[model samples]
Target: MRQRVVVRHSPVHGRGVFALKALEAGERILEYKGELIAWKVAVRQHRKQGVSGHTWFFGLTDGRVIDGGQRGNSARWLNHSCEANCEAIEIDDRVFIHALAAIAPGEELFLDYQLITDEPADDEIRLGYACRCGAPGCRGTMLAASDS
Candidate 1:
């Protein structure tokens, strides 16, 4: 079945993506798009303001890559939270987000936005204008993955 991320009314981070069905552990959520660039190229691309800006690309020494740079799909719409409900682990050239705990039928799914980078957060980076995820240990700021 075509998986879809649904946004539900939340008390903490406004609306956020939730899985429509039970997603197995290590399930593939979506694959990132756009051309794969070298690490330096990706960094320079981040500096430029071009449309379709480069995403964090990965290439192993054996000429393989697992790029999940957020061009589109529900992965882009997914939000950040300190107490994220899910975690994405890279395996066999694919990025997968699985439930750390059993997510209920309608619970909003979350993954910590700041996990892999030192991305700064302001009003603009906040997805959907505001956050209301109501996750326990919720930080007041949207996209603030941690209070520390």
Candidate 2:
């Protein structure tokens, strides 16, 4: 079967998923796949690896997180955008990426990573998650708006 998405260098960040063909709004694109792990383990792994700033941890409603860096797919390349053309939907413990609006071929897919944080989003923390999406209404941070 032909692939629907491709991972490539992104001006927004390190890598990004791009549409290979025109996708209509509401189209189911890809599943955000990864190894299931506890938050503590994920944190410990991140610290041990000395990784900070951008991460590919997708939190599930069940209190577990998908450590995309462990066994992620092209969907893990999806970047964050304030005016995103796609969105992530959680179903059962898996997350799916769906188009929020019509997308053209070669367009980079984006999700509004509304990442919630455990601590207050002070300037220091906020800067750590700073948004480089350059969306018209970019919120400047990847954390949830409430945190900003």
Candidate 3:
């Protein structure tokens, strides 16, 4: 089968996934693959290793996270966008990327990444999850709105 996507240096961030062919809306593009681990362990690894900026961690509804850094695929390169073209749908313990709208060839894939955190969305926390998607109505941060 022909390739569906490619990983390359991205202007929005470091690396990104780009569609190699036209994709229809609702098409299953790729699965966000990686090793499963608890959020606590991931947090420890992050702090102990001092991993900053870009991360390949995808959170699951079951409280576990997929550490894409361990065994990730091209989907890990999908950057964040306020106006995203794709959405991450979690089924069971696995997550899959689906096109939200028709995507043209060479267009970069993006996920909203409504990252939620227990800490207050203070300036420092917002800066940590700062978004560079450059969408017209960018929210500046990748975090989801708090129920405040």
Candidate 4:
């Protein structure tokens, strides 16, 4: 079977995954594969690497995280968008990026990285994690609204 997507330079961000063919809503696009690690380990590795801005660490339902930077696939290229066309579904400790809406050929796939944090959404935190999705209602930051 032909590949359903391709990775290329993205106007939204760095590299982005685009549809090679029309995709129907609810179609399972691809798996977010990577090295599975404990949440603490992922945190330590991220800190040790001094990585910022972009990240490939996807959180799992069980508190573990997928370090996509290690052994990730094309799924790691998906960019964040406030108006997203895809959604990441975690099932049985695995993550699948599924189409949230019908996507046409050459359209870039996006996932709403509703990244949650325990810290307060202060000015410093917001500026550090600023977003440039350019969506109509973009919240200006990738960090999810603080629950506290």
Candidate 5:
């Protein structure tokens, strides 16, 4: 993958990464940077009407909250898959992902967005995007733990 950006047509993920170049296993894909807000504040701001969802909340270096929903980097754009190839972790409040195994150059990097969360909040909901992570016996709906 390139230093800044990597482009590939992912077979597993409908036109994703396609060998942007031979990438090593456990390589750094991208970074998500922004403020980190407390759970209370994040829930308040993100608690909008229907379909509007959020990813994760983090405590920032500048003493602010960075909600992956409102302000996040490329990692935020990465889609979710049940059979994921990547992972998300928080070290000292900084969130990141590491390849679980060797990812081929052209393979689309995938991570289960749910890995960071056990279950969605009561009011948290999904609009349309269904879960097609290609994982075995996947629950068709991506939105789980819905209040409505």
Candidate 6:
């Protein structure tokens, strides 16, 4: 099979994953590989990083998270889009990126980063995790609309 994707600079955010060839809907793209860490540890590391911008922690269903910042693959560069073309599926402690719709060659792959937060989404919180996907219906923040 040909190289299906590549990581490059993205207009949506910083770096992002882009499809190198046409992809069919429902196609399993790539696994989001990283260091498995507890949620608390992930939080601690994220805070320690002291970066105000992006993050690479992907939550898993089993209460742990994949710290993509360490030992991560190209999938970690995938950015968020309100009108996403891809979806992240967590299965058995692993997360995979899947095409949600037909994707054309050279198209940037996107996933709805419906990030959940324990606190209410106030202005300060929303500002911290602002969205720049530029989708028509962009929610303005990567944070989920409501606390989860």
The local distance difference test score of model 3 is: 0.82
TM-score between model 6 and native: 0.85
- Model 4: ten consecutive residues of lowest lDDT: 117-126
- Which parts of model 6 are misplaced by more than 4 Å? 118-125
Instruction: Give the per-residue lDDT digits (tens) of candidate 6, residues 112-142.
Output: 8776654454565556567878889999877
Residue pairs in steric clash, candidate 6? none
Model 1, 74-101: lDDT tens digits are 4544555668777766565455566777
Pick the winner on TM-score between candidates 2 and 3: 3
Model 5 lDDT tens row, 17-120: 23255556676666656666664565455455223343444434343455665566555545567666776665776766677777775567766654222235
**In candidate 1, which residue pairs clash?**
12-131, 12-132, 12-133, 13-131, 13-132, 13-133, 14-131, 14-132
- Residues 1-148, candidate 2: write the lDDT tens digits: 3689999998878888999999999999999999999855755565565425457877675657788887888887888888899988999888998999999999999998776655465565566567878878999877777724
Please report the TM-score between candidate 2 and the true structure. 0.84
Each prediction's number of clashing residue pairs: 8, 0, 0, 0, 19, 0
Which lDDT value does model 2 have at 140? 84
Q: What are the Cα lDDT values of the candidates?
A: 0.50, 0.80, 0.82, 0.80, 0.53, 0.80
Off by over 4 Å in 2: 40-54, 122-124
Best candidate, lDDT: 3
Supply the TM-score for candidate 5: 0.59
Q: What is candidate 1's CA lDDT for residue 45?
A: 43
- Which candidate achieves the best TM-score against the true structure? 3
In candidate 4 the C-alpha lDDT for residue 121 amounts to 49
lDDT of 3 by residue, 20-137 (tens): 9999999999999999988667655655544255767787877688888888888888898999999999998999999999999999999988766554655655666678778898
Candidate achieving higher TM-score, 4 or 5: 4
Candidate 2, residue 113: Cα displacement in angstroms equals 0.7
